[model samples]
Target: MNSHKNASLTPRGREHLVKNIASQGARKAADAAGISTRTAARWKRRYQLEGVAGLRDRSSRPHRSPTRIGSDKTERIEGLRRNQRLGYAQIAERVGVSKSTVGRVCVKAGLAKLPPVQDSVPVRRYEKERPGELLHMDMKKLGCFDQPGHRVTGDRTRNTPRAGWQALHVAIDDHSRVGFSQVLRDETSHSACDFLIAALRYYRKLGVPIQAVMTDNGSAYKSRRFAKLLRRLGIKHKRTRPYTPRTNGKAERFIQTLLREWAYAYRYPSSDVRAAELQPWMQHYNFSRPHSAVSHKPPAFRLGFDGNNVLRNYT
Candidate 1:
C-alpha cells in the first residue's frame, strides 16, 4: 500500500517500531525489554501526534508500482542472471523484456551488480622483511610512438626516434614497495639479467645488498648464467609458479603502474621515440615519485640496511 524508499531499516528504527507495536498489543512485554525511558516517550509522542505511519520513515517513491512486473517475469530475470552471467541487456533480450525490467529485477533480487573482487589476503607474497632482502622482477612491452604522415607511427608499437613502446623490466622490494626498472628493446633473458645486474648495482650504491631475488618462471630467470650469477652474489633464488603473476605481485603492480602513468599517460610519435623517453621517466619514478604503499615516502627511504638485518618488513 505504501511506497518504497530505503527498504533497509536500522536496528534502532526496528526497535522503535517494535516498541510502538507492543505498546498497543502488549505494554508489559515492551517495558520488560528495557526500552529506554527517553525512546519510549518519543515513540508515544510520535504515535499520538502522527499515528502509526508517523513512527515510520516516509517513502519518497511514488504511491503505486506503475511498472509493476509480474512475479514470474522477475523470477525469470533472476534465473538468467544466476544461471549465466548475463548482463542487463542480454537478459532483457533473452527474456523478451525491456532493459529496465531486468535492471529492476536484479536490484530486487539483491544481486544488482557484482562487487569488485579484491582478495583480502594480498596475493603479493612476501619474500623478505627489508628493502634489500628480496626483490621481485617482471617485464612488460609497450608500443612505439606515433609520427605524422607515417602509418607506422599510427600504431603504438612503431619504432621511432623519440617515440615507441619498449619492454619494461621492473624489480621491486617486497616489503617496502621500493621499485627499480629498466627499459630495453626486447624482453630477452639477457635483457632481464642485465636489468638485474643494474638493479644490484643500484642497491649497492645505497649500501644495501640483496639477500634474495624472486622472479616468475621465465627462461631468462631459468638460465644457467642467471643461476650462477645469483650463486656468485651469494643471494638465494626463488621462482614463483608459472602463470601466477600475483605470487610476484609487486613487480606486476609496477607494470600496471607503468601502463597507467607513463606509457598510457600521453601519446608519443613512435616506438623509437617512446622507448627513448623511458630513461628520464624511470629516473623520475625511482627518485622523485612518492609511493602510497610506503606511506607517501620515496623508495630511497628503505635503502642502506645494515648487513646484520636481513629483512625490512615482515608480515
Candidate 2:
C-alpha cells in the first residue's frame, strides 16, 4: 500500500510544482509566475506518466557561452609580444592586463623567449674622422721562451722561468689604420717617448700633422718624461679613462690582430728569435694583409703609404 501511495512534495520541488499547477494552461500566467509553459506541460505530462522525478532541472546550463576570450585575444597577445618584446609583467603594465592574463594569452599564442648574443670585442670604436689626426698607442707583452734549452712554440710554456719581451709600442692612425710598431725590452716612459718620436717621424714622412696621441693610463704613459716628450714634440697627449681599454679602440684592435696572426702563429726557442720573428710578420701585415674595415684594402693602400719596397699585395 505504501509503494502504491503517491508522496507529497519537497518544500523546493513542491514550490515548483505548485507554481506550475497554479498557472495551469495559461502561458502568460506561467511566465509571470516564473514557470515556462513547456515546463508546466512537462510536469503534467510526467504526472500523467512517471511522477515528481522529471520536475528536476536536466542539466543546469544551456549548451554555450559566447563570453570566453576567443582567437582574437590570442592574436592580440602575439601581436603585442612581437611588436614590443615585453615580458609578462611589462606587457601587463603596458597593455592594461593582468600578468596571468598575459601569460595565458602568450601560451595560447605559442610565444618563446629569445636568448642574448655574446659580446667579446677587445676594442670599442670611438668616432674619428681623419687619418693621422688621432693616433692610438699601446704595448703588448708576449712571452719569449728564451729560457736556456727550453723549446717554445707560441703560447706553449714550460713551468720554468720565462724571458719575455714587449712588443714595443704600437701606434695606429684612427682613420687610415696605418700602424707603427717595434719590439722593445720593456714598457717604460723612455720606451714610449721613443715610440712617440718614431711615430712623429713617420707622420712627418707622410707630411701630415698629427693632432693628438691617445693611449692607456699606464704608469709608463702617465709619467712626466712622457709628458715632456709630448711637449717637446709639440704633439698633444691624451690618456684613456681609468681602466677603460675600449677608449683606445684602434690600438686594442691592432693588438688583437697581432695576437691572432703573428704572436701565436709560430714558436720561438728564445726571446731574440721571437723578436726577430715579429719584423717579418709586421712587414706582411702592413704590406700584404687586406684590412676588412677599409674596403678590404691593405692599410698601406688606404693610408696612401706607397711602399715601393713592399713585397706582396694581400688582396
Instruction: Highest lDDT: give the candidate number.
Output: 1
Candidate 1 has an lDDT of: 0.70
The alpha-carbon deviation from the true structure for residue 307 of candidate 2, after best TM-score superposition, in angstroms, is 7.1
TM-score of each prediction: 0.58, 0.56
- Clash count, predicted structure 2: 1
Model 2, residue pairs in steric clash:
153-267
Q: What does candidate 2's lDDT look like per residue over 200-231, in tens digits? A: 88766655579898988898889999999788
Error of 1 at 160 (Å): 5.9
Candidate 1 has a TM-score of: 0.58
Candidate 1 lDDT over residue span 2-116, tens digit each: 5357533343554555565566543543454455555656665677787766667655688888667788888888988876768999999888889987888799788788544
